[model samples]
Target chain A: MTTGSPGNNTPLIEARGLHTFYGDSHILHGIDITIHKSETVSLIGRNGMGKTTTLRTLIGLAPPRQGTIKVHGRDIKKSKVHKIVHQGIAYVPDDRGIFPNLSLYENLIMAARSGPNGRDDWPLSRVLDLFPRLKERMGHMGNQLSGGEQQMLTIGRALMTNPDLILLDEATEGLAPKLRKIIWAVIKQIKKAGIATVIVDKDIKTLLEISDRNIIIEKGKIIYDGDSEKLIKEPEILKKYVGV
Target chain B: MEFSFYLIQLLNGIQYGFLLFLVASGLTLVFGIMDVINLAHGSFYMIGAYLAFWLTGIFGSLFLGIVLAIPLAVALGFVVERLAIAYLYKKGHLHQVLLTYALILIFDEAQRFLWGNDSHGVDIPAALSGSITLTDIQVYPVYRLFVSFVCIVIGVGMFYVIQKTKLGMTIRAGASNRQMTQALGINIERLFTIVFSLGVGLAAFAGMIAAPIDSLYPGMGDNILIISLVVVVIGGIGSIKGAFVGAMIIGVSSIFGKTLFPSMASIVVYAMMAGILIWKPQGLFKSA
Candidate 1:
C-alpha cells in the first residue's frame, strides 16, 4: 500500500529487484533505481542492454516477473500500465509511436492529463508556444511530420500528460545533429520546469550534458550509476561498461 | 432502366452507404482504440433489431421503440464487455477471435432461447411511414431517407467527438499505442470498456434502424459482420475516416453491382478489398 504526495519529498518512481522477460528469455534482472523529483536521469548502454526493457517494465507493457515498482512511494508493480499512469508516470518509446492517421493536435490532446494547476499549466496554447513548428503543422497528420517535428511532438505529448516523471527511450536515435541539439535544449527547458525525467539514448556525451546523473547498464545489469561529471572525468569506467 | 430510375438508385446507394458508415465507424473504433476484435459485434445489431421489434409492438410507437432500444442495447454492450471482453484483452488476437466467435454463438443461441427462431416485422413510425413522390411510378420510402438522415447526424456527431473533443484524442492515442496512452496517466482500461460498449451500441443502433426495412430473423447479423469486415479491410485498421470512405465505396459498389451484374455483387466487393490491400497493404488509412 504505497501512499504519499506524488510530488514533494517522495521519490517519483522507485524500482527494487525488478525482473522481466520476453517469453522464456529473461531480459531484465534485479534492476533497482529511484527517480527523485525534478531530476534528469539517463540510462546509457549498447543495443539490447535492457534500457528499453527497463522502461517497458515500468509501464507494464512487459510487466516484471519479480520485484516492486513504487510510484510516489507507493507499490504499483501489480497495477496495469494505465493504472500506473494514473499514479503519474509518462513513457515515450524508442519508435516514436505516433498515430499516423491523427493530426499533431490530436496526438497531443490524447495524452493530456489533469494537472495540479488545473487549467493553469501546459494548455494547448502553451504547448504550441513551446514547439512553434508544431503550431504550424497542427493540422498535419503524424506521418506527415518530419523526423525532428515528430520528436518535438513526442516530447510535447509527454509534457501534456503533466507526469511527475517522464521516461524517454532513444530520445535522439535516428535524428540529425541539429534535431538532437534541439531535443537537448527542450530537455533543459523541461528540467527548468521542474519535471523529473529519465532519458535513455546511445549518445553518451550529449545525454551526459542534459542528464544530472547517468547509469551505465551492460547485459541487463547496472554496471555503474553515478553523477555525469564523475563518469566524464573517468572515461575509462564508461568505456569499461559501455565500450564507447 | 430509365435515366431517372438510375438516378434514384444512385440516391439509394448513397443512402445505403451512409448507413454502412454508421456501423463501420464503431467497428473500426473498437478495433483501433481497444485493440480488440469483437466477432460478436453483429450480435449487438441483431439484438437491437429484436429489441426494436418487441418495443414497437409493446409501445405501438416506432420512435419510442427506437429511443428505448438504444439504451437497452448499449447497456447490454457494457455487460458483455465487462463479463467477457475484459478477460480477453491481454490474450492474443487468435484468442479474441475464438472467444468472440463463441460469444456470437452464445448470443445466437440465447436469442433463439428467448425470442424463438422466427422472422418478425417492425413498422416505421407514423411520422416516417409515408413516402415522397418522385415520378408517377417512383416513390422513395420516407423511412429510408430518415435512416440516411439519422446516419449523417450520428456520423457528424461521432466525428466531432473523435476529432474536436478531448476524449477523441485519448481514443486516438490509445489506438496508436496502447502502452504509451496508459503511461500518460490515461485510465486506459476504463477507456477500453467504454469504447467497446460504444462500438456495440453503434452496431445496435444500425440494427434498430434496419429492422423496419429488412425485418428480423435468426442469423441476421452473420452477413452484416462479414460485410462490415470488408469495410474495415478496405478502410484500413484503426481509422474512422477510412471506415467511412470504405463503407461508402462498398455500399455504392454493392448497390450498383447487384443492379448491373447480379452474380458478381459480392465478388466485386471482395475484389475491391483485395485491390486496396494490394495497393496499400495497410488499408486506405494507416495508423502506426
Candidate 2:
C-alpha cells in the first residue's frame, strides 16, 4: 500500500455533488471539495453550515446519498466506516471521542496502526515529542485529562494511526489561547511532516495563516472556494456567507 | 454444631454465586456490547447440563463428557447468535425482549421434545466424588470445591482479558464508544460475533460443571435466566467485576433469606435489588 510521493497532480480526495442528511433534515447538498497531498485545507462556515458533514461524509460516517466520493482515485461512497478508516483517512471528531475508561497511554496506543507504506511513521515517541504533557499524564485515564489535554490526545491518537490523510472538525473549539497556540503549532508541524490535513475551526486568521486553501460552505453547499489569502481578502464573502 | 450448619450454608451460597457468575458474565457482555436483551441466554445452561448427561453416559467418563461439552456449547452459542439474536440488534428494547422471550419458549419446548419432560441427573467424576469434613457433624463435597476453583480460574482469566490485553482494550473501547472504535479501523461487527459466542460458552460451561450437583430439569433455564438478569442489573450492566460481586451478594442473601424467611425466599433477591437500585441506579461498579 505504498502511495506515490506528494504533489503528483492527483488529488488525495475528490468529492463531487455530495448530498448528506441527518434523518429528514438535508444537510450537505451537492457540495464538492478536492484536496491535494500534504496540503492543509480549512472549511470555513457559520454554525450549522455543514462543515462537519463534509468530513463525516468523506469518512463514510454520514455517507452522501446523492453524490460520489473517491479517496485517491478509489470509489468509497458506500464503504463502511472501518474500511474507510483502513483506507488511511483518520478523523478527529468534534467530541474528541476519548474512551473515558482507557488510560491516556491506552487511548494513544489503541489507534496505533501502520499507514499504507507499513511504516511506524507516528510512533509513541513521535507523539510524546509533539505534546510532552501527554507524556506526563500517560498513566491518567482519558476522563482525567483537561479539555485542552483531551483535544491534544485526540490529535495525537489520530497521528498514531499513521494515516495518509487526516480530517479535523472544530479541532480548536473551547480551548484557551495558550492551548490554541499549541494546536496551531502542531498543525504547522503536521504540514511539515508532509501529511495532508482538512481542518474546521472558527479562527479565520489562524486558518488563513496555516492552510494552503479555504472552502466556505452554507446550507450544505460549497458557496466559496479559493486560496486562503484570497478568502480573507473578500471580507464581504465572509460577511455574506459566514455572517461575520 | 449450629454455627457449623450456618457456615456450611454460607459456603453453599458462595458456590451458587460462582455458578451465577458463569452465566451472568456472558449475559451482561452480550447485552452491553450489542444491547440485545437475550432472555434465552440460560438455555445454553440447560443444554450444557443435558449434554453433560448424554456425553457422560456415552463415554463412561464424566471428565471426558465435560471436555467434549465445551466446544459443543460454543457451537450452540454461535448458532443461536447467528440465527436469532443477530436480527434483533436494531429493534427497540421491547421488540428485543419479545423476540428473546419467544426464543426462550422455543428452547424450552425443544428441550422437552428432545429429552423428555422428566429430570435427568449427572454423577460427579470419581476423583471429585469425595468430601472434606469441616466439623464433627458437617462435611463439604469435593466436587463443589472443584467447581468453585474452576470458576475462580475463569473469573481471573476473564479479568485479565478485559483489563490487561490489547483485545480487552478494544472491547473496553467498543463498550464505551462503538462508533469511535469503528472509526479507529476495528472490525467491530466481527468482534461482536466472537464476544457474543464467548458469552454463550461461559453460561453453558456453568451448567456443564454444576450438572453433578444440580439435576437437569425442564424449565431450569427459566428460573436461572431471571436470576442472572437480576445479577446483571444489580451489577452494572456490561461489567464482569460487577457481575461477580453482584452474584456473591445475591447468592448469600438468598441462602439466608430462604433459611430465615421461607415464605419470602422467592422475592428476597428482588427486594435487595430494589434497595441497591435506589442507592446507585447504575449498579455498584459501572464500567468507567
Candidate 3:
C-alpha cells in the first residue's frame, strides 16, 4: 500500500500482508513490500530482521503462511520457485550457492536464459563484458574462485536468466574493500540497464547511495519505508529500527 | 597357472569390471542426482536379464532381443519412478531403504511368478560366439571382449552426456543443490523422473549384457545390489568418474584376490570398500 517512487508507475513486485513462519516460529508478521520497475530497493536492518525471509518468500524458497505475492499484477504465492523465475524474479542467496564441481563457464551457461518474453537482452558476451574475469577463468571450477569472483559469478549467473528483477541477499557480506567497490559499480550498471533489483546488505551508507529507496525492518515488521534522502534526514529511525 | 592362463584371468577381471560399471553408473546417478537410494535397482538388472532371455527365445535372435529390451526396460523404469519412487522423495533415507527394499521383494516374487524358479541360459550372439586361439592349450572367448568394449563405449557415452551437454549442467546443478537449481528455472521434478528412468535403464542394460555370462536366476540381484553399493561408495557417492575408478579397482582387486589368495577372494571387494571408506569416506574421485 506504500509507494516510494512517484515517477516509477509500474509495480514489478507487490507483497501484501505477508505472514511467514519457520516451523512454529513466526518470522514475518504481515509485512508488505512494493518494488517498481527500474528501481533499486534496499532492505537494511540488523541480523535476523526478516530481510532474507522476505526475499525467500517472494521466490517461493519459503512460501508465506498467509498473504499474497503478485508479480506483474498476477498472484504468484502458490507458484514454485522455477515458475517464479519465469515471473521475472531471480534470487541470489547469502551463501552465493555456487555449484563447486561446475566450471565457471558452466556456472554461467547453466542458468543461461533469455529475458522476459524471450528477449535476448543479456547474453554471454554482455555478461562477460561486465565481469571479464569470468571469461579468463572460464574453465575454472566454482570452488576455485576467490570470494569476490564468486560474488560476481553469482550475480552474473542470475543475470543469465535474463530476469526483470533480481533479489540479492547479503551481496557483499564477506569481501575485500576493492571487491565491494566493484560490486556496487556493477549494481549501478545494472540500474543503468533498466532492471529492477532488491538488495540486502549491511553497509548502510554505500547501500543507501546505490538504492532509490530504503526500508528499515525490525523484528519482522517494516518500521520505516521511505526515500534515501528522507532516511538520511531521520537518524532516530535508523538508530531505533536498524541500530545504526 | 601358465602365462596365457594368467592373461586370460586379467581379461576376465576387466570384463567383470566393465559390467559392474554399467550397473553402478545408474545406481550412482540415482543416488547423486535424485538423492534417492534405490534398493530395488538390482531388481531391474535381474528383470532385465530375464526379459532378455524371454525375448531372445521368442525372437530367436540375440541381437534383436537386446535391441527390443532396452526401451522396454527404460519404460519400466519410468513407470516405477512415477508410481512409487516419486512419493518417497521427501522421506528420510530410512524410509527410502525400507520402501525400496520392499520393492525388491515385490519385484523378486513377481519375476519368479512370471519366469519360474530355474536358472536359464542365454546364448551369445553369433557374431561374438567364437574364440581366438591364445596358446596350444588355451582359447579366449570373443563374447567377453565384446562385452568389455560395449561397456567402455557406454561409459564414455555417459561421460559425454554428463560433462559436455546442457542437460548435464542442469543435472550437476541439481545434484549439488536442489533448491538453487529449481530457482534457476530448471524443471527439477521432471528431471528427476527422467534421471530415475535413465538410471534404471542403465542397470537393466547391464543385466541384458550379463545374461549370457551370469545366467538368469531368482537371487542374482541380492549379491549385485550389495556389490554395486560397494562400487558407489568406493567411487564417492555421486561422482560418475568415481564410479568408473571404483569399478575398475573392484574388478581388478577381486580377480587378483581370487588368483593370489583364494581364501580372501570373496571378501576382497568388501575389504577394499571398508578400507577406502575409512580413508576418504567420500570415495576415490571426490571432485568439486
Candidate 4:
C-alpha cells in the first residue's frame, strides 16, 4: 500500500469502508479507495464486480450504507450529489448521459461553471479546442452525434465544470479503434492538465500504461493496490483478478 | 354565417387558445421534467382569479390588483411546490395523482372558506375596457386583444428561455437524466422547485387575466383543469410547443362547434383530441 508521499499531504478523495447496496442486493463489501492529487488511478475488475458502484458511491450518487467519503478532509458522506460535485469532482457515467434534446453548445454551456474557489481554468473555448470535433458539430443536437462524438461531448461537458477530479466510468466502452485512440489521447491531456482521474475501462493494457497507480477489485473487495510498474511486473495477479 | 362573423369567431378562438396555452404549458413542463402528475395544477388558476377579485376590491384599481396578484400567485406557487409537490417527485404516478387530487379538494375547501361560495366579476381595467370595431356591427374588446398580446409576449419569452438560455438547457438535461444532471454539479432539487413554481405561476396568471372575461366562481378551476389536461395530452405531455399547438386546435374546434353544431358543441374538442391521438398518438411535438 502506498501512503501519502512528502508534499502530497492531503488526498483529493478519501473513501473508507464503503458498503453499498442496490435495492436488497449487496454490491460493495468494505471497499476503501484513495485518490491523490494529479495522480491517474485505474480501477480494473471484471463486469458487474462493483466497479461502477464504487465510482457511484464516491460521487454520492449511490450513498453507501456504511462508509465515510471525504474530499480534502471534509466529510461528504451525507452531502447531496450536487454538493459533492461542487467540491470540484465531476462524474462521467457509464451510459454517457447526454441530453438528447439539447444542442451540443447547450449541453456544454449548461455544465459551465467555475471550479472550487472560483477557479476558471477550463473555459468553453479551451474545452472546444480540446475536442475540435465537438466545435465542428456545435449546432447539432446531442442525439444527432455518433457514439464516439457523444463520448467526446460527455468528457468535454465534464471539463466545462472545471472539476479538480473526474470519475470516468467506461471511458471507452463501445467505440471503434480510431475513436478509442482519440479518447485515450484526451484522457492523457486531462491528466496532463493536473486533474486527478479514476478511470474504469476494459482496455487493461492501455490503462496499465497510462495510469500512475492500478487498483484491482474482485467481488467488491480490493485485491491489489500498488504502483503501475509493480502491477506490470506481476502478470499473474492481473491474469487472476482482471483476466488481462 | 357572414364572413365578419367567422372572422370574429376565429379571433375569439385564438384568444381562448392563448389562455389555454398559459395553463397547459406549465402542466406539460411539470409532467415532462418532474414526472409528477399534478392534478391540482388548475387550483392555481382558480386561486389566481379569486386573488384578482379580492385584490381588485381592496386596491380599487384592476391594473394594480393584477400586478400585485402575480407576485402573490408566484409566491403561493413557490410554497405549494416546496410543501406538497416536492415530496411527490420520488413517488409513482398513482401517489402523485392521489396527493394532487387531494390538494385539489383542499384548495377548493380553502377557496370556499376564504372567498365564500359565490360568483364574482372583475371589471376590465379602464384602459382595456374599450372595444375596437372590426366591422360596423362587429366590435372586439381591447382587453381580449390585450390578453392575446400579453400571452404572445410571454410565450415568446418562454421560447427564448427554453431554446437559448442556460437555465433552459439545464431543464432539458434534467428531463433527459436527473442523476447525470446532479452528477454534473447542478442542484436539481432547486431546479425542480423553480420549475414547479414557474408552472404554478403561469397557471395562476392565466386565471388572473381570464377572471374579467370568465368571472370568478366556485369550482371554476375544475372545468379549465379538464380542458387544459386535454390540451396537454394532445400536445404530448412535457412539450411546451405541443401544448401551444394543441390548445389552439381545441380552441378553434370548440368555438366553431359551438356556432355550427350547438347540440354537440361539448363533444367537439374531445372528438378532435381523439382524432389527433389516432393519427399521432405521441403528440404533435415529442416531449422536450
Candidate 5:
C-alpha cells in the first residue's frame, strides 16, 4: 500500500524523463509516469507509438538511454532485467515467450523464484488457483496450448514470480471478445489483490473500465494523462490517439 | 548370420547408443542453453580416458581412478568454458566454430605432449573382465553389459533430475528461451557455466568408462564429437529426449548398416541426419 494518497507523492513505480533507442532510432522520448499501489493503469496507443517500447525500457529489457526508473522508491536505472525481476517486477512480453517445448507446469516452476519478499506470495498452488485453466492442462507443452491458454499460462508464469507489479504487453491483442473479457476480469481481480498492473492494449473501452488512470501516448510522448473516467469523457482525444 | 548373432549385435548397438546419449546430452545442452558450440567437448572425453589410464596405473584401483578422473575432467571443463566458451557467448556462430576448433587442436597437442602419440589400452577391471555366453554361437562381454547398465542408470538419473527437480526446470527453460529465462531472474551466466561443466563431466565420464573397451587414441575425441553432433541434429536441437532417441537410431542404424553394407555404414548416419533435417527444419522437437 502507498504511504501517501494518490496525487500527493507515493507511487509504487515512477518513470521520469525516460528515453529509449533501438540501434540509432529513438523510440521513447521524455516519458514520465507514476503508478500508485494496487492501481491498474492502461497504456493506449496505435501501432509503433512506443507503448511496448516504454514497458520494455522500464523493465530493463531494452536499457533506457536516459531515465530514472524507481520501484518502491529504489532507483533501478543500471539494473539488469533479471535484477529488476528480482525486485518484484514481472513482465509478460507481447510474444508471450513461453517455453514452447516445456510442459506448462515446467514453465511456471522455472519462472518461480523466491524474491526478497519471500515465497508465500505466489507458490505453484497459488498460481494454479489464480488460473485454473493452467491446472487442467498442467502436462501440456507450451506450443500445444491454444492462444487463450498460452496467454493464461504467461500470466500464470508471471504470477508465480510473486511480483508486486505485473506488466502486460498487449494483454488481449489477438484474443476473441470472450477471452478479452476473461483477461480483463483477471486483471481486475489482480488489482483487487493489491498487485499493481500496467497493461498495454488497443481495447480502449475495456482498458478504461478497469484502469485507475489511462495514459494516451503519441510519438513516444504522453499526450493525455488523467483518471479513466476523464479519459472516457474525452472521446475526441481518444479517437485522435487510439484508433478505437 | 544366425538370429543369436543378430541379437548380440542388437544388444551391442543399444550399448553403443546409451554411451552416445551420455556424451550427446551434455553437448546438446551446452549448445542449446549456453549457445556455445564446443568442438572440444570430445577432448574432455579423451582426457578422461587418459586420466583414468594413468590414475589406475598409479593408484592400482580402478574405482579410485574413475572417481578421481571425474573431478579433474570437470575442472578442465570449467577452465574451457571460462577461457573459450565465455568469450563466444555474444559472438556469432562462425566465431564459436572457429574458437572451439582451435580448442580441439590445442587439446590434442597438449594431450600428445603429455601422453605421447601411441594408442594406449586401459585394463578392464578384473570384476567385469568376464563374459556371458548366450548360446553355442555367441558370447557377450560382461564389461559391455556393465557399460550398458552404467549408461542406463545415468540416463534414468538424468531423466529424473531434468523432470523432477528445480534445476532441471531451469535447464529446460534456458534451453527453450535463453533471453526470457534470464529476464525471469535466472543468472544466465552461472547457469551457462554449470551446464557447460556438467556436460563436459558427462562426456568425460563416458570416455573413462569406454576407455578399457576402446583404445585411447589422440583423435578419438574428433570421431565421438562428430557422432554426438549427428545425434543432436537427428534428435532435435535442444530436446534431451531427442538426443536419447537420435543416439539410439544412429547407434542401431550404424550397427545394421555395417552388417548389410560394411563400407557405407558411416554414410547412412549422415544420410539419416540429412533426411531428418529436410523433414523438420527446426528439428524433431523445436523448443519454443
Candidate 6:
C-alpha cells in the first residue's frame, strides 16, 4: 500500500510541550508529535515508557499539565473527551473498553454517526464487511466474545463513528498468530481507506512493514521521529530504545 | 376469609405494587448509571404529591394538575442534578448520602414553607370517581384501577425504550462503561443529566398518581423512600426488571400481612428482604 508523504497539507493532530502527570508521578515530559492526513504512525516504545500516555493526552483522556493540542489546527488542550472526538478522532484503549452489557450489534450501532462536516465514509455495513467475524456475533454480548473478536469489535465500533483518525493502543496483544494476521490486514485496509492512525503495537517487523512514519518514545520524550524504512536499517537504535 | 375479601386485598396489593414499581425503577436506574446513592429520591415523590394537590386546586382537574406537575418535576430534577448530584459522581457513597440526605431536609423545609404541614387529600377525577361492583358486598374504586392501568402502560413503555431504542442502548453502555461511552463521541455529561432528570420525573409522577389514593403530608416521602430502597435491593441495584418483580412481591406480601397478621404487618416486608438476601446476595436480578 502507498503511504502518505509529508506535504504542505495541514496536519490532523499536533501536540507540543506535553507535560502529563498521574497523581504525583509525572509521566509525559515535554513530548511533541505531529500526524498528517492519511498517515500511519507507529508509537513504538518499551512498556511504561509513555506511549499510552501520549495517545491518551492526544485524545484528551489524560490532559497535559502544560501543553497545547491542536486537532485540524484548532486548539483543544482543555476540551473534554467527547468534544475532542467530535473533531474526528476515535480511541481504542489497551483494555479494548467494550461494554459487557451491550451486544455486538448495540455496540456498533451505538457509536454510528457521521464524522466532522458530515463525513459518512465508514458506516455500520462497511465496518461489518471489514470484519465478517463481527457480523456473525451481532447478537452476542461483548463479554462473551473471545480476545480476538473483542479487539475486532472495538475497532469496528471506532469505525462506526466515521472518524478521520484512530488511536489504537495494543492493537494485537495476546492474539494467536492467525488472528494477528487478520488484524494487520484490517489495519492495512484502514490505511487504504485514507484514515490517519497512530498504532502502538509490540511487533516491530509488522510496524516497519506498514507504517509511513515511526516515532520512538523513551521516558515520556520523543527520542526518534523519522521514516520507517530508515528506522529498519538502524538495528542498534531499535535494540537500544525499543528492546527489540 | 371470603372470596370477595381476598379479591379486594389482591387488587389492592397489585395496585400498590405498581405504584412502588414507578419509584423503585427510578431509584435502581439512577444508582446503576450514575452510581449516586440519592437519599432524597423520595423527596421527588413527596413534591409530586404536593404538586398534584396544589395544582389540582388551581386547574380544577386532577388530570391537568398531573400534566402540568410533570414538567415542573422534570425541571426540578434537572436543576437538582446540575446544581447538586453532578458533583457527587466521583465522591464516596458516604459523601453522596450526606449531600442527598441534606437535600431531603431542604426539600422538606421548602414543602412546609410553600404548602404548609397540614395533610391534604386529593379528590379523584369525577370521571374515575365511580367504583366497580365485584360482588354483592364487594366494590373496587375505578381510580385505583386507573392508577394500576396507567402504571402498566408506563412500565411497558419503559421496557420498549430500554430494550429497543438507541437512547436506551447508549444508557446501558453508559452504565457498563462510562469512559468508553465518551470515547465513542457520546456527550456523557449530557446523558447523565437526562438520566437524572428522567429518574426524578418518574419518582415524582408516581407520587402524583398515588396522591388521590393516599393522604399527602410532610415527610410522606420518608416511608416510601425506605420501601423503594428495599425494592431496589431486592431487584438488584441496577436492574429495572428486578425492581418490578421486587416491588410487586413486597406490595402483595405487605397487603396480606396487614390483613392476616396485623400484629406482624411491619415486620413482614423486612423479613422477606432478609430471606431473599440470605438466598441471593446479589438480589433477584443481576445489575445492568
* Candidate 5 residue lDDT tens string, B192-211: 88889889899999999998
Better of 2 and 3 by DockQ: 2
Angstrom error of the Cα, residue B53, model 1: value is: 0.6
Candidate topping lDDT:
6
Candidate 6 ranges with C-alpha deviation above 4 Å: A1-8
Q: Lowest lDDT 10-mer window, candidate 2 chain B?
A: B81-90
Q: Give the per-residue lDDT of model 1 (tens digit) for B11-58.
A: 788887886777777788888777888888888889888988889888
Segments in model 3 whose C-alpha atoms lie over 4 Å from true places: A1-10
What do the candidate models score in CA lDDT, each in turn?
A: 0.83, 0.88, 0.88, 0.90, 0.86, 0.92
First chain TM-score, candidate 5: 0.93
Q: All candidates' TM-scores?
A: 0.92, 0.96, 0.96, 0.97, 0.93, 0.96
On TM-score, the candidate that comes out on top is 4
lDDT of 5 by residue, A1-244 (tens): 3222233355668889999999999999999998877778898888999999988888888888898998778889998778888877889889998988788988888888775456456788977787888889999988899889999989988888877778899999799989888888888878877888899987777788888888888999999889888877878898777866
Error of 4 at A125 (Å): 1.1
Q: List the residue pairs that clash in candidate 6.
A: none
- Interface DockQ of each model: 0.59, 0.76, 0.67, 0.85, 0.58, 0.80
| Per-residue alpha-carbon lDDT of candidate 6 for residues B28-73, written as tens digits (9 for 90 to 100) | 9889888999999999999999999999999899999999999999
Q: State how far residue B34 of model 2 sits from its true place (Å).
A: 1.4
In candidate 3, position B50 carries an lDDT of 88
lDDT string, candidate 2, A1-244, tens digits: 2343334686788889998998898999899889888889989999988988889899888988898887777888988898888777899999999999899999988889887647668889999999998999999999999999999999999998888789999989999999999999998988888888999999888898899999999888988889977877889998998777
Question: What fraction of native interface contacts does model 5 preserve?
Answer: 0.77
Fraction of reference contacts reproduced per prediction? 0.83, 0.79, 0.83, 0.98, 0.77, 0.89
In candidate 3, list every pair of residues with a backbone clash: A101-B288
Ranking by lDDT, best first?
Answer: 6, 4, 3, 2, 5, 1
